[model samples]
Target: MNLFENAIKLRGFLAEDAKVPPSDGITEDAFSVLFLALMSGTWDIATNEWAPRTTVHRVVCPGPWFCGFTRGMKRGDYVEVEGELYIHDYDRPVVVEGERSTAKRYVSEIRAIQVRKLDRPLLVIDTGEDG
Candidate 1:
């Protein structure tokens, strides 16, 4: 098989190995709501203050701390978030300075891990589910 098929097979094996029995719900990070919003093309514009668009398809909670903590994450660190997503708009693009834009969207989660990039303020959001 080709590389893609190999990767898929490997992923299935990894999932089987990593799978754990579901536990009682854990507290998820707040930013997960924002994550969902960016993916679903929606945002909260209701408050129009800290989250000026309070009415957004707000995915990832985007808590005050999450926003602040992104500055502190290192190359190997992981962040966690828990929240829901709105389904209003996804107009503003998730633009990385150099990387090409993607059609893929964000998903909801309780927590995330942020892998730091060299010489950049943004971190790759490790949704715990996806890389």
Candidate 2:
């Protein structure tokens, strides 16, 4: 037997408000999508310093419960998300080198099973000068 698993956990700030599309009357459950920005530091061996890096990720909150939970989140809010990774592939029209064409696009997103808002203060820097 072969065992497989796909899981991801991320801690970051909400890049924007949760996006929930209006119900189409086909599905009873509500769905939501969120953009999160994760920041980290990368160390450079030669430079002997650390550099900041930011990555934005798309998170999907499916079902009425998850959607409702995300509705309270807003931009700049720190949050933690736990979920599974999913990749969606679709065709999109594009113009490459002045030629119109259709291309296949792949989008990787996290299907969130758990989300939590963390109460943390933003970093502040003081220059010691008062105006």
Candidate 3:
């Protein structure tokens, strides 16, 4: 299942178990990451809509993988994805070399959704039904 669906299932299980660890465990971190990933589902696919000016990254395999930049990449500069730090062959995903505004905004938006709203659980994986 996708991150959201899995989060929902995991959340259900966690709620039933009184033995769940205090919220400071590594598992909690993992859960938080999962939550963010699920929250990013829409943006990941439609990133062009979010940052149309930015270059689109084409992964060799199917992916909506989260990429962290060591430095703000500029056009023609090389970038590394996953953990291949030594390989600088991957083209950076920005039209302007040092423009991190769009990328930062995308991430910040996802974070905003998570932190600003606390009324309901955000644990359902997107099935392309809700946009």
The count of backbone overlaps in candidate 3 is 3
Predicted candidate 2 versus true structure: per-residue lDDT over 4-71, tens digit per residue: 88889999899998887654521556679999999898899999987999899999888877766776
Off by over 4 Å in 1: 1-63, 90-131
lDDT of 3 by residue, 50-114 (tens): 42233232222111112111112223322222311111333335556666433222211111111
User: What C-alpha lDDT, on a 0 to 100 scale, does residue 125 get in candidate 3?
Assistant: 70
What's every prediction's RMSD, in angstroms? 20.1, 4.0, 19.4
Off by over 4 Å in 2: 22-27, 121-131
TM-score of each: 0.21, 0.78, 0.13
Among residues 3 or more apart in sequence or in different chains, the pairs in candidate 2 whose N, CA or C atoms overlap within 3 Å are none
Ranking by TM-score: 2, 1, 3
Indicate which candidate wins on TM-score.
Answer: 2
Residue 49 miss distance in model 2 (angstroms): 2.6
Task: Report the lDDT tens digits of candidate 1 across residue range 61-116.
Answer: 24444444443333222223332223332434456887656455544233323312
Model 3 has an lDDT value of: 0.24
